[model samples]
Target: MNQTTNTVHQDVEYWLKNIVVGLGLCPFASLPLKENTIRITAFLGTDTEELLGFLEQELTTIEKSDTSQIETTLVAVPNCLHDFYEYNLYFDSIDRLIKINQWEGVFQVASFHPDYQFSGTEPSDRENLTNRSPYPMFHLLREDSLEAALKHFPNPEDIPERNIQCMEKLPEKQVNELFYYLFNKR
Candidate 1:
């Protein structure tokens, strides 16, 4: 792989390990990650159509691959969807694509962006960091695995609240330092 690809993958993995799992933002993530079942693919494209095509290919790959080998997939789009608003707007088309492809229940998409912010929250709110990643990414999770994880997890409804609380307690300096690379362009 090229240097850019290596750097992207490393950044994504670091976020997954440090912020996501390390902070217990997603309690279910650690297991799959430890087992090496999470697939992180980088698509270096700024065009929306090309990114969507890559998303389609990754979805198909997940659908055909063995569940035991690949529990989830993260399509890291470092070039496109840098703007959170544009990234949010693209979800409708993403959902449509899922439904059109008859992957409604079989697969689900979760979004993470560098500037992700919850509705009604200010741009600088610390809670927004919960959904922020090293880059814009479309996280594809298998419904069955998610269901299984949820079944074992107690009070799954409290996850977002808990994550928000955790993020809120973090010092702004630490948060900014950890994610500085995300906001700064190469």
Candidate 2:
């Protein structure tokens, strides 16, 4: 990988470890992460077409692989979709792409960004931190894996509430440290 790609990949890995798994935000994340089954790729393309194509390739890659070898993928796009609203608007195309490819039910996309925000909350709300990441990345998850994980997990519906509470309890210093990329963009 080039230096930029390497840096972004490392940053994403750090965020996944310290913020996501360490905070207990996603109970299912730790296993794949520890097993080295999570794929993190930095997509440096700035064009929408290129990104969509790249995503299609990634989707195909994960879809064709066994769950034990490739559990999930995080495609980090640091060169495009900087605005939260614009990034969100692009999801329509993403959904359409998934449907067209007939992978809608097979896999799902989860979004994480530096400026991630929930619909009913303010941008400054601590709850938004739960979905925040160092860069704008699309998490391609397997529906079957998610279903299995949820079945084994207690009160899967409560995960969101628990994550929000976890975010709310964090100190400002800790937030700034864990989410330093929020303040310093590439």
Candidate 3:
């Protein structure tokens, strides 16, 4: 079992490494392109102007004389929400602003950082667990109503019926798996 786990871990490590290097680029250079690359952009939702500026700047940053192009994008997420809500919001925000003309490859980028709350600089970049305070990232995935908005919606009598319903917590492994589900490519 441990060996199998090791093999899986190594595979994941390899995949992640590939993502870092491959997706390290963006595709909209309009110049020549390169090899074995998957360009990407990561942006915060609250900053639209800056994100566009950064995207324009990267066009020069990743350009080469070769004819191959890197998949470029203007990724952005909401500043306040940790992951999902911000992710969704930013997607919506840019969905309107994205210029479809003069584009190459995929025009991708969104607010959701997979499991943003748990994915960060720590312990080999592992996902956050359910034992943890519900990550703010979850705010974007879907609101649990009373379970989530209790502090803001303090009118005890005004709670919604959908929120009043209880949800079972996932087991530890399940929680971890959920993080993987959200982050991992399908």
> What are the lDDT figures for the candidates, one per model?
0.88, 0.91, 0.33
Ranking by TM-score: 2, 1, 3
Name every residue pair that clashes in candidate 2.
none
Residues 1-186 of candidate 3 have per-residue lDDT tens digits of 122333433433332343222232111112212333334333333455775465545544444312234333222222434545454565554444334423233233323244443333343233222212211121111112223434554464532222212112335464344345344533
Q: TM-score for model 1? A: 0.94
lDDT of 2 by residue, 79-134 (tens): 88989999999999999999999987898999998899999999999999998888
Which residue runs does candidate 3 get wrong by more than 4 Å?
1-15, 18-34, 40-46, 56-81, 100-112, 116-186
RMSD to the hidden true structure, all candidates: 2.1, 1.8, 16.3
Q: Candidate 2: where is the Cα deviation over 4 Å?
A: 1-3
Taking the candidates one at a time, how many backbone clashes does each contain?
Answer: 0, 0, 20
Cα miss at 163, model 1 (Å)? Answer: 0.5
Indicate the worst ten consecutive residues by lDDT in candidate 2.
1-10
Best first by lDDT, ranked = 2, 1, 3
| Lowest-sum lDDT 10-residue window in model 1 | 1-10
